[model samples]
Target: MHISRRQLIEGSLCGAAAIALKGYAQPSRWQPGTVRHLLPAVSHDRLLLKASFGRPLAAPPTLRAGPRAATGVRLDSSAEFFSFDLAGLEPEHTYELVLEDAAGAPLCDPWPITMFPGPDAAPDRFRLLVYTCAGGHPATVNSDTDSPYFVSIANRRKMLLTGLSYEPDAMIAVGDHVYWDLRSPVGSVMLGNAPEARRLVGAFTRNLPVPGTDNERKLKRVVTPQISDLYGTDFRSTPVYFVQDDHDYFENDEATEEMVTFPPDDFMLRLARATQRLYYPEFLPDANRPAGLPSSGAADRPAGVSESFGTLRFGRLLEIMMYDCRRYMTLTGPVGGFVPETVEEWLMQRMAAEQTRHVVNLPSTPVGWSAGKWGEWYPDLLQPNGELGTARPKYLWQPGWNRQHNRLLQAASAMSGVPLFLSGDLHALGEGRIMRYGDLDFRGNPVVTVLTGPISSGPRAWPSAWRGTPPRTPTGIELEAGLDPLEKNGFSIIDFTEDRVEGQMFNWKMGEPVENLDNLQPFHRFTAARGA
Candidate 1:
């Protein structure tokens, strides 16, 4: 039975009318006819498996592991997400997808998902491409097409596709997947004269414009910009473990205090929520409920909503802790709020339990960018502070809250013996080691922090380098210029094996490798014990 758009529309209207007349209500679990397509069931290759999203929604309409066929497994709700254990799949094989309807009928369309067997068993290597701050431009007075930014992002995406040809495990996008509130003129012709290109860029801006509107035309204009000359589909299908940054919410440095006073107009939040619905695959289950609602029983659950932060574990070797810094952070000036005390406590508890060999903290904001410089600038906002002008202080350059965040970092490093901290948001790629007492004090272990900047956004070079200064704490680590011109926007690929981890920062523009301070040509490799 082919379902046309008109038929689907008619069916939807009829279904709604039927429900209203019969006083039928949505069920806690989805009914067969509620949605057009049901998500595929998933299973992992190993018996010991754990998966989580931010919400209780079903898994994506499709699932991918390795290239092998995955056996159908029952999914159980763990409050945060649906978890599936793949107890009967072959090890070291790529598990493609297994589709099934609510009644367990095979959906018949198979999409391949790649999963790597644990490095614990053999010397297996997997590459992960991490990036952020794409899909929107700042409200600056630049005229040219800034093709470098777009070209760089396209190169990175191409590189990922190239890596996938080699079958890497996953790509971790460390937040800001789509910047919703960037500024661009409406219908303004592109100075570059690429009308189609201009339209694509314009679409992204219109989709989630700042001080948002409910009109569909405006939102569509922002997201599906006129970038036909640049590329098509906006790099949508690249599999990514996405976490939400401040841009995903509305603006930068937005916190509970600022939200209260300058709450996004209802239309803006709605628009943001809609964009999230369209882009992100899954969210934390707890974030599905309305704000301030009790966890156990919520009568008015918002439809198609989810949280953007959580954690996922790959056996006992690796644990990815994705944090929502924007949701809980405080603005820079008056109110000195940081992560809510409760979330902080939860994070601490999670960090204290140290079973994994490596822990990666993915915060939207770079954990340690200096106070003065981070975001792009606009002439309209008045400058407040010194060289670190307070102009547009409300959005970025939030130093006051760093006191609390710094402690959180210290605690995380102290508790978890994890060596690497992966982050994005500075729009520049830089790597540093977190030290203690002004020296290499890694609490009896070695830890390295790798920051990868924006995928497609222009690099704020001068301010980024100025802000890249290491913190001045007694435990402050020395900042060696790992890869100079980190300002050239790009992504970092980290390959992990049982014995060592190799980190490579790829320059998207030149399509080549970047060397660290050690002068290792092409790629930078760091060897450490699995647990150290």
Candidate 2:
């Protein structure tokens, strides 16, 4: 469903049609479906949209500057889809992205596009969100009869509203955006490396004749629409950076790192495609992978499937190293630790930048704390693994990753501002600063680590308090942890400026008797400055 750029912007059937004037609400012939998904993704540079009966008749959507100001791709399935980018937008200006019908009447409510401050714009202030493990299975039901989807949707809406109230410039959804409907048991037992033709007997769906098929279809029903409802208003105006986790990738807590990238027919591959297609904006290659991997419409594009790591910047105040720790990962490292080769270089460069006030390295899996069930990362591996009669491979101190981790820290120490680590998955809110064990150089440059989670999912049980005595990893990088709190169901916030970076964990409840963001206070708060 590729419509050439010329057809969209040029005078097509919709060009001369009656376009609804801006800022005024009017009746529209091109009615949107009950669900209209208008999401702002990528940098402040792109807009992603999905609406039923949502496509414009001929002329492309009219931006603040008009129809001709946009370019990129448009895709249509049962619903109308779009991923158009607006380049050359003025810095700090808010643009209106409006869709219309053949008659030119605006189809859905117009969305606002806010551009980041320009290169010359003051690098003074910006706000970012860090969140993960949003609502999913084992429904936190309002009523016993309510389905998991119903309960999850209610919670998701609350989280979105709370976030919008903060008016963040952008959001970083760290991972577990949507968990597979099946429980974690399925993931542990089956394998992502299985052949595509191997079909599981029960692929669940919201409504199915056989009652247990369309595993991919259930995702569209149970999760995607909830996302549509959650970010309904805010996404139109703000960018949402998606970093996927195991559930969204394959099963519950695993990404298939098979040497061979599976073909389109594979179940796991099919599941990944469905998640990206219905909800998230299309995938783009990181600098590590070449861009413009060919698309076959049904198959996951080459770079799209392979590349998950990328970067984001805001004025000169901040730069983010968004890591894809799950995909392309092995039990141990060769050159790349948990991260891919291309992304490691990109992150290191940012950490070393003199003008970059803050560099936030976000891994979908936490390096600070976790449930200890998963085996790959630092926190998860620290917990005892009964299967091994020991902890998972200690990557933090192991030869494979130790050197890379040290290099990353050294990069931070060499810069003007101490870089911060942002993570989620512990289902708790915690903050801690690192020091080379037993060394009281607390006044020296320190790396800050902040953890927040349980966006709408059930919060995990975290220790009321705990820390290692001069906690030393395999490689002897000594550290300590503190201020950890559990049952704080919400997202993390980071407010950045040249002087300091402040973090807070705000709480949000899932069901009836809705709570107010204003009345609630942060469960934990911490700040990172130039010199510890």
RMSD in Å for model 1: 13.6
Q: What is the C-alpha lDDT of each candidate?
A: 0.42, 0.50
Error of 2 at 506 (Å): 0.9
Ten residues in a row with the worst lDDT in model 2? Answer: 12-21
The TM-scores of all predictions, comma-separated, are 0.59, 0.72
List, in order, the clash count of every candidate structure: 41, 3
Error of 1 at 139 (Å): 14
Put down candidate 2 lDDT per residue, 1-532, tens digits, no spaces: 2222223211111211112111233344332332256655544343344332223334334333344344224343333444444544555655556655435565565445566665445668788877876635333232334433223554555455455555677778877665442433333232222121124223443243211245633454545444655554335556767776666654554222332221122455445555655566543333332343222222432224323665566667777767666555544534546555555666676666554577678776565344324333433233332222124443332244434556666666556686577877555666776666222233367667677666755312222222111112222234466564354567777889887988877775544334353344566677777653
Best by lDDT: 2
- Model 1 / residue 121 / CA error / Å: 10
